[model samples]
Target: MLRTIRRAAFDQARTQLLSPLSLLAALAMPCVFAFVLHSFAPGRTTPDMAVGIAGIGMLNAVIVDLLGAMSKEKVWRTLYPALGSPGGLVPVVLGRLAGIAAQALVSLPGTLLVLVLAWGISPDFDWFRWLAGGLLLAIATTAVVGLLAYFLLRFPSSPGMTNGLTGILIALSALLVPNAALPAVVQPIAWLIPQSHVMAWTRGGDIPQILIALGQVVVFSAVVLASLRRLERIAREQSVPLEY
Candidate 1:
């Protein structure tokens, strides 16, 4: 299982990160989005928050890659064969989840570097806080990615359906602006999104809030696993096979 996870992560990095064309396609839009986010922020004191908001765009890029990978598996008729493997589908799906997280982790440094150099944004926190925040962000991103992957895979015909939800999530995250600043109608929705608290932790939120963010990740992960199992059962009942 460990080997599978490693191989999956490696393959994801190679295909998406190492491939010149894929890198260009994947990074282009995110870079543009990041620039726009920086323009909105335009604040020197809260550089960390601004950078975090920009970095969120990169997370979206990773999500798109994972969605594309899943779409290819189904379109190319490889999902069934993958599920039928000796290790079963759980490890494969878990590996994909891990791979997606790993890909995001790997890209974070470069993302930060770009924000620092290009946007002149520097996190005002200490090294220890930065490290802890990075760890939390990775876990948070994994949970969010898993949930979105479940939706995309479950409703393969409407892959773009998750985009609207993701946009709402980003807006509700309060990365670019404080939740208090949000419009009255949207303010309540911000409380429901984990980022309301999660981002706070990275920006010096209390211990309790950080723990809540961690708890959210755990709950989201379990939901993702349960959804995967349900999908597997449906595939079995349908007797889906990879017909070449």
Candidate 2:
């Protein structure tokens, strides 16, 4: 089962890179936001600015690879038949997730390289302390959000609607802005989204905050998986398919 999923994951990465939508989105959104936000930021370029761009990149990771891919399948009604088969959901989920993982595998190292070569920023990647936590959070964020996008896909029956919802989620994440700047009610709402927390942690902003973020990821993951399980059971009963 794991092997099948891993194989699907491999195919997913190859196909994702070939996707024109994914390639353009992966690069363009981050660069454009990076330039615009950096322009408005008080300093010529602040750490927050860099973090925001990187966060957009991560959100793009979810958008292009997982949410986008899932919607693409369902938009064509390709996913439902696959979901109906045995050993099918495993590969489908893993393959979609594998594509999303490819985004991070591309971005995180790329960000570090750009910082070192182009920006002349230095980070202690080899440090006994930094490597473990950094790698862990990066993986954790990707895994949790990939799963969330899968569940969200279940809610959107059409590709366009699913894609649009993801874009809106990214915007409201508020990694580009501050919580206090938002209306009081919205601040708590923003904090509820993992993208907001993932962006904060990716920028090397706060550990305690990210720990809380990881907690949210774990909680949401459990809920999404459990819900998916229920949906699958309902589908098996052939009882008019409510979760869809």
Candidate 3:
């Protein structure tokens, strides 16, 4: 299983990270947006936006990679065998995500460097805190990845719908601004988003807040996994063909 996961991860890394254009966009767009926000937003808000944007960019890139990995088997008309293989498809999907996560980690430092050099902003925490913060971000993002994977498996052909939903999640998250600045109705919604906890943590929220984020992540992941199981069952029964 570990070997399968590693191979899947490696394949995912090559397919997504080796694309020069995608890599360029992933590395450049966050810095560009940060520069714009720094120019326009009040000085006090720049750091918050910088962290939010960097986190968003990293998660966004990896989530897209996961989606691609999920779809590739279907694209190649190999979904049936892949899913029917020993230990089922979950491990395979996770293996692919391990690779995607690796790529995201590789790109993150450059993104942070851009934040520091170009936007004049970066997280100012001790090493341990930074590690904890990264864990929180990963937990939150894995929850999201689970949700998005459910969607991808549920509607294998509708990449646009999945992409649109991803956009909506980002909008509801603290990636754009502080949750307090969001409308009252949206604030509750933001709490349910993993990225919201990330924003709060970035701004120095305490351990209790981290607990809440961890809880949300666990709940979201559980729900997503259950849904994926059902989707896999249905797909196997219906024998859904390769979807272009």
* Runs in model 1 lying further than 4 Å from the true structure: 19-34, 37-47, 119-125, 157-162, 240-244
lDDT of 1 by residue, 1-244 (tens): 6777676666666666664443543355446666776676664334345335434654665566677666665676756666777654566567766766666554456555665667564445355555566556666766766776665666645636556654666677766566777899998777665666666765666888777877878887888888877777776787644332
| Candidate 2 lDDT by residue in tens digits, 137-208 | 345546556556545545645545445654565556665776556678777887876656655654555777
Q: After superposition, which runs of candidate 3 have C-alpha atoms over 4 Å from their true positions?
A: 42-50, 119-131, 156-159, 242-244
Pull out the clashing pairs in model 1. none
Supply the TM-score for candidate 1: 0.80
lDDT of residue 239 for candidate 1: 63
lDDT (0 to 1) per candidate: 0.62, 0.57, 0.65
Write the candidate numbers in order of decreasing lDDT.
3, 1, 2
How far is 239's C-alpha from truth in model 2 (Å)? 5.9
Error of 2 at 51 (Å): 3.0
> Where is model 1 poorest over a 10-residue stretch in terms of lDDT?
43-52
Q: How close is each model in CA RMSD to the real structure? A: 3.3, 4.5, 2.9
Residue 231, candidate 3: Cα error in Å is: 2.1
**Clashing residue pairs in candidate 2 (N, C-alpha, C atoms within 3 angstroms):** none
Error of 3 at 27 (Å): 2.2
